[model samples]
Target chain A: MELLKERIRAEGSVLPGNILKVGSFLNQQMDIALYNEMGKEFARRFSGTKISRIVTIEASGIGLACITAQYFNVPVVFAKKHRSANVSGDLLSATITSYTHQTEYTVILPKAYVRPGDSVLVIDDFLANGCALEGLVSMIVSGGATVAGAGIAIEKGFQGGGDRLRARGVRVESLAIVEALEGPEGIVFRK
Target chain B: MELLKERIRAEGSVLPGNILKVGSFLNQQMDIALYNEMGKEFARRFSGTKISRIVTIEASGIGLACITAQYFNVPVVFAKKHRSANVSGDLLSATITSYTHQTEYTVILPKAYVRPGDSVLVIDDFLANGCALEGLVSMIVSGGATVAGAGIAIEKGFQGGGDRLRARGVRVESLAIVEALEGPEGIVFRK
Candidate 1:
């Protein structure tokens, strides 16, 4: 987490609307070295959880989940935002609104991937409104899988999504929690 | 590649329109163990090239690219299919037509990631129309970067995407090339 925070302070840009753009390393362009560290941290944080699978929603989450999955030695199941002709079998689909794009889309996964009593860990790059996380959680529940926990790179704590999931008894661990942010003032994390 | 072919033959469902659904392992639900093997193979295939970065399209390609990047000891840069408040700086955007979705969408990547003289290897889950690869190649070329080669998990030989790219002098190593596939007759590969 210290390394991630340092990387964020070094390369992250603060934009209007309290947005933290990490495209240089985290989202658009990924730093695999950093990703591997994050993965090890997640593994340490969620050790002995017996994660059967890692769930995420595309497109940013795929990279993180895949890399982190190596530490867990598990598979990754991502919910697709769009329909694919190749996808068959019973599926668990949930609709979620993208706070970034400001549009509603469905996230889908095959039922065969996550079965009853599977322990699933959700991972993503960022968690703001938590709509994407919500959709993934719903899909996991539909498949009768238990959410081992959720690992996020950055969390906008002011948005209250992380807290809400914790209140529901879901284990949510975020590397850096930004309690607040402002133009030129940079970021403030919850103590 | 034999492992990939066996998995596909066992789990991949043959749908209408020559679609091979390997979502249970390749895209939607990813097998990290298998992915790591694929990564090792990609590393072996491109061992001679000096790959500075791994470039891939959004959504599904992110996972394979990131996992494969570890073997190459380089960073992974995935193009974004959707816009966001987080995406800033000048971008290189390419419009791609998705035959599966039957629509056109633009993929964007920050200009800073792929700079002049950078050697990028494009990786993706599948190769059908070659449009996605073309988009990434275009962005890399626009940034004055050199494309060392391409790695694809599965290439539909009938669709001609892989052949077309190879015709352009791009070194493409497809783990499994489906020379022909038919219902009941099963898939035949080009050895």
Candidate 2:
């Protein structure tokens, strides 16, 4: 976690409107070593939580979830942002709005993957506005699965997504939580 | 490879229009253990190539690429399918026509991560018409990087993608090449 926070401060760029750009490592181009570390941290945090499945939304979350799945010994089921030809099964779908994209999209998962009473760990790269996490939670609820908590790589703590989930009693763990950022001053994390 | 083949035969659905669905393992719902095996196999196949980076596209390929990157000890650089506020860097973009979705989408990678003359290992979940691979190849070429060939999970040999790449003298190694799939009667491989 300290490593992630430090890397974020060293490389993360702060744009207007609270957008933290981590494309250098946490995103567009990934650091597999860091991902493994994050995976181990997640495994360490949620040790013996009985995670039967790891669920994530498409694109960014897939990398972390797949890497972390090794520690959990579970299959990773990612919710598709777009309908694909291969996605044909009873699906658990939910609509979520993205503040950055300024659009709403539906995320879906195959029903066969997450069954009743399955303990699930929801993982993602960034959390803002809590819309994406809410969508994953909805799908998990729809599947009659238990939410075994969530794990994230970097979180925009100012956005209040993490707090909202915590308020709802969801155990959300973020490796690096950015409380504030200014030009050259860099990112500040919650103590 | 045998484990993957067995999984495909047992859980993969032979959908209409020659679509073989292995979503339960390879893509939508991912088996981490199987992916580790597949990734190891890819490393074995491309053992001699000095792969400096592993490049792949988003959504499905991210999972496979990240897992495969472990074997290469290189970072995974995944192309983004959707544009967002987070992605503001100079990008290498290419259009890819999806064989399954029957639609075309643009994939983008940041210019900062993939360096010039870097040896890139292109990894993806499935290879049909190879449009995605071609798109990735274009991006890598635009970046002045050399593709150390490709390591594909499954190649639909009945389709022309892998053959075309091979005919062009590209180094392509697919773990399981399916020549034909006549329902559960089983998959035929090209000798």
Candidate 3:
């Protein structure tokens, strides 16, 4: 986690409107080595937990979930996000509001993938407003599965999403949590 | 490659409109073990090639690219698909028409990631009309990088996308090439 925090301090730029762009290493252009390290850390954190499946939202979260799933030895089921509210009986869908795009999109997972009594561990790149994570948790619950907590790479603590989930008894683990992002003083990590 | 072919024949379903759904393993619900094997095969096929980076499109391709990148020991850069044409000067954008979705979207890759003299290996889950692959190749070329061929998990050979790219002198190695999709007889693979 220190390594990730350091990398964020070195390369991450704070854009206007609370956007922490770690696109250089975390999301867009991925560093697989770092991803492996993060995966190992995630595995260590949730070692004793029963994680039957690793679920994530599409696009950025897919790689991290896939790499991290290798350590857990579990299959990763990524929910697909659609711009429209198209749903079917065969699929479990949830509507999520994106803090970045300011849009509401529907995220869906096929019913056949999530089975009853499955303990799902949610993995994602950034946890800001927690809407995406909340939507994934709802889908897992709807499918008669248990929430096995979440492993996030970065969390904006100032946004208060992770704490809200923690208050609700959801074990959310964020590798790098930015407590504050000052304009001239740079990023401040959660100590 | 044989393992991948076997998986397709056993689990892949031929949905209506010539759609081969291998979501159970390759994309939606990912099998990490199989992905590791496919990654090894990709490294073997492109063994002597100078692959500085592995490029792929977002969502499905991210997992595959990241898994395969471990074998190549190179970074993975995934292009993000946006509904609108909101590209900037720092990004290389391409317009691609999806054969499945029947919609056109803009795929953008950061210019900073693809450097000049870099040899990029394009990785994707499926290749149908080659529009997505072509767009990715153009972006790599636009950034002055050389295409060190592509490594695809599945190619609908009947769709002619892989063949078209091969005809253009690009080295495309698909793990499983589907020759035909007979509804009654099941899926057929190229020998």
Candidate 4:
């Protein structure tokens, strides 16, 4: 987590409306080596838990989830933002409002991917308001699967979404948690 | 390649309009082990070529690109389908038409990611009409980067995309090329 925090401190910039831009290394342009470290950390954090599958949303989360899935030796099921012609069959759905895009879209997963008795670990790049994470958890639960936990690369602790999930008893393990995004003064990490 | 072909023959379903759904293991639900093999195969195919970076489109291409980057030991830069508040600075852009979705979208990448000396290898999950690949190639070239070539998981040879790219003198390495998709007889791979 220190490495991620260090990278964030070095390259991350605070944008208006509480947005932390780490696109240089995290999402848009990915560092696979960093992803591997974070993936290993997730595996270590959730070592004892049984993870049958790893779930994440499209675009950003897919890379991190796929990398993390290697440690668990499990398959990754990404929730599609919209239903496509290729994705056919009964699907478990949840409506999610994007924190970044500010648009409400339905996220869905094929029912056959997550079945009863499956332990699913959700992964994503960022957890600001946790709408996307909650949507994924909802779909996994609807498929009769167990929510092993959620692993996030960075969490905006100031937004309180990670804490909210914790209150709901979801084990949300975020590698780097930003306590405050004080402008000019720099980011404050949760120690 | 044999493993990929077997997975396709066993699980890939040919849809109504030439859509081959391999979501079971390729895109929606990803098999990390299989991806690792494909990554190794890509490394083998593109061996001896100097690859400085791996480029891919967002969503489906991210996973394969990330996995493939491991073998190349380079960072993966995925083109964003749309501009977001998080992505800042000058960008190189290209217009791409999705063969599956039948929608045209502009893909953009930060100019910083691809420099004049960078040798980029484009990676994608599926190559149908080669529009997406061509778009990515255009962006890389516009950035003054060299196109090291492309590594695709599955190329619909019948659609003429991969061949078209190859005809353009681009070194395209497809793990499995589907020469034909017979209705009842089943899918056929090019030798």
Candidate 5:
């Protein structure tokens, strides 16, 4: 986590609306090396949790979930934001509001992917309002699967998504948590 | 490649409109073990190439590219399908037609990610009409980067995309090449 925090400080930029852009290595463009470290950390944090699969959303979370899945030696199932022709069969769905894109979209996963009694670890790049995480967890629950926990690369602690999940008895682990941030004041981590 | 072919025959399904769905392992629900093998094969195929970065499209390609980047010890820069608020700065863009989705979308990558003289390896889940690959190559070329080669998980050989790219002197390595596929005839692989 120290390394991730340092990288964020060195490369991350603070924008309006309390947005922290770490596109250089985290989201738009990725640093596989940093992802490897984050993967190891997630694996370590969730060790012995009986994780059967790693679940995530499209785009940003795919890279982190896939890289982290190698450590768990499990498959990754990413929920599609939109229904496509390729995605058929019965699907578990949840509607999520994206604060970044400012739109509401349905996230779905095939029922066959997550069966009864299966344990799933949800993974994503950022957890701001926790809408995406909540949507994924809802789908897993609907599929009769167990929620092992959630693994996130960066969490906006100020937004309280991580704490809210924890308050609801969901185990959430984030590599780096931004306790506070302002455009001119920079970022402050949750020590 | 034999492993990949076997997986396709066992799990891949033929849908209407000549679509082959390998969602069980390749796209929807991914098999990390198989992806690791694919990554290793890609690295071996393009081992000596000077690949500074791996470029891929959003969603499906991110997983494969990120996993493959580990072997190359390089970063991955996935083009965004939509312009998000987080994605800032000048970007190189290309329009792509998705044969599966039956739509066209613009793929953009920040100019900073793909620098001049940078050697890039393009990775994707599937190569059908080669529109996506062509768009990615154009973006890379626009950024003044060199296309080292391309790595695809499955290539619809009957579609002629692979052959066209090869005819243009582009080095394309496909893990599994589906020579033919029909509703009742099942799937056939190229020998």
Candidate 6:
């Protein structure tokens, strides 16, 4: 987590609308080494949590979930943001609004993937408004699966999404949490 | 490769329109163990190749690229299918038509990621018409980067994508190549 926080501070940029851009290493251009470290950290934190599978929403979360899954020795099921022709059969879906894109999209997973009573760890790259995590959790619950917890690479702590999930008794772990960031005022980390 | 072939024969289904569904292990519900093996196989095949970075398209290709990047000891840079707020700066973009979705989408990558004269190995989940790979190759070329080769998890040989690339002197290594697949006729693999 310290490594992630440091890399974030060194490379992360503050943009308008309170946006913290870590795309240089976190999302668009990924650091596989850092991802492995984050995976090990998540595995250590979630050790003995009985995680049967790792679930995440597509695009950004897939890489983190896939890398972390190796440590958990579990499969990763990413809910597709778009319905493709290749996707068929009954699906468990939840609609979530993206604050970044300013649009609402439905994320879906096949019903057969998450079975009843299965323990699942939801993973994502960024936890901002918690809409994506909520969507994934809803799908897991809809399939009668148990939400083991959530793992995040980075969390906008000031956004209050992580706190809301924590208040709901969901175990949320973020490698790097940005406490505040607005224009040239610079970025702050949640100590 | 044998393990992958066995997984496909066992779990993969042939649907209408010659679609082979291996989402249980390859894409949707990903098997990390299998992916590790794939990473090893790709590493073995592309050994000694000068690969500075692994490039892939987002959503499905991110997992494969991330896992494979460990073997290459390089970072993974995925092209974004959609323009998001997180994406900034000038981008090298290419339009690609999806054979599955019957839609066209532009893939974009930041200009800073792929440096001039950098050797990049393209990785993907599936190679059908090779539109995604072509788009990725184009972006890499546009960035002044060199395409070391391509590592495909599965290729539809009957579609002529792999052959077309190979004919152009590109080193394409596919874990499994499906020669043919028709409804009720079963799938065939190229030896």
Could you tell which candidate, 2 or 6, scores higher by lDDT? 6
Summing lDDT over every window of 10 consecutive residues in candidate 1 chain B, give the lowest-scoring window: B179-188
CA lDDT, candidate 5, residue A140: 97
Candidate 1, CAPRI quality class derived from DockQ = high
Q: Stretches of candidate 1 above 4 Å error?
A: none
Over the stretch A91-161, how does candidate 5's per-residue lDDT look in tens digits?
99999999888899998899999989989999999999999999999899989999999999999998988
RMSD to the hidden true structure, all candidates: 1.4, 1.5, 2.0, 1.0, 1.1, 1.1
Cα lDDT of model 3 by residue, B1-191, tens digit: 88998899788877666788888998889999999999999999999889999999987888999999999999999999973222233888899998887888998998999999999999999998899999999999999999999999999899999999999988999999988896456788888
- Poorly placed runs, candidate 4 (over 4 Å): none
Screening candidate 3 with a backbone cut-off below 3 angstroms (N, C-alpha, C), the clashing residue pairs are none
Candidate 5's C-alpha runs over 4 A off are: none
Question: Can you list each candidate's DockQ?
Answer: 0.82, 0.85, 0.58, 0.88, 0.86, 0.88
lDDT of 6 by residue, B1-191 (tens): 88998999999988777788989999999999899899999999999889999999988999989998999999999999988887889899999999888889998999899999899999999999988898888899999999999999999999888889889888899999998888345878899
Q: Between 3 and 5, whose TM-score is larger?
A: 5
* DockQ (model 1, Cα): 0.82
Q: Which lDDT tens digits does candidate 6 get at residues A37-125? A: 99999999998889999999888999999999999889999999978888899999999999888899988899999999899999999
Q: Could you give the fnat of all candidates in order?
A: 0.90, 0.88, 0.67, 0.89, 0.84, 0.88
Compose the digit string of candidate 3's lDDT tens values, residues A24-83: 899889999999999999999999999999999988899999999999999999999973
lDDT of 1 by residue, B15-90 (tens): 7778778888898888998999999999998888899999999888889999999999998998888667778778
lDDT of prediction 2: 0.88
Q: How close is every model to the real structure, measured as TM-score?
A: 0.97, 0.97, 0.96, 0.98, 0.98, 0.98
Give the winner by TM-score: 1 or 4: 4
Q: Which 10 consecutive positions of candidate 4 chain A have the poorest summed lDDT?
A: A177-186
Candidate 3: which stretches are off by over 4 Å? Answer: A83-89, B83-89
Per-residue lDDT of A52-165 in model 2, one digit per residue for the tens?
Answer: 999998888899999999988999999988777777868889999997788999888889999998999999999878999998998898899999999998888888999999
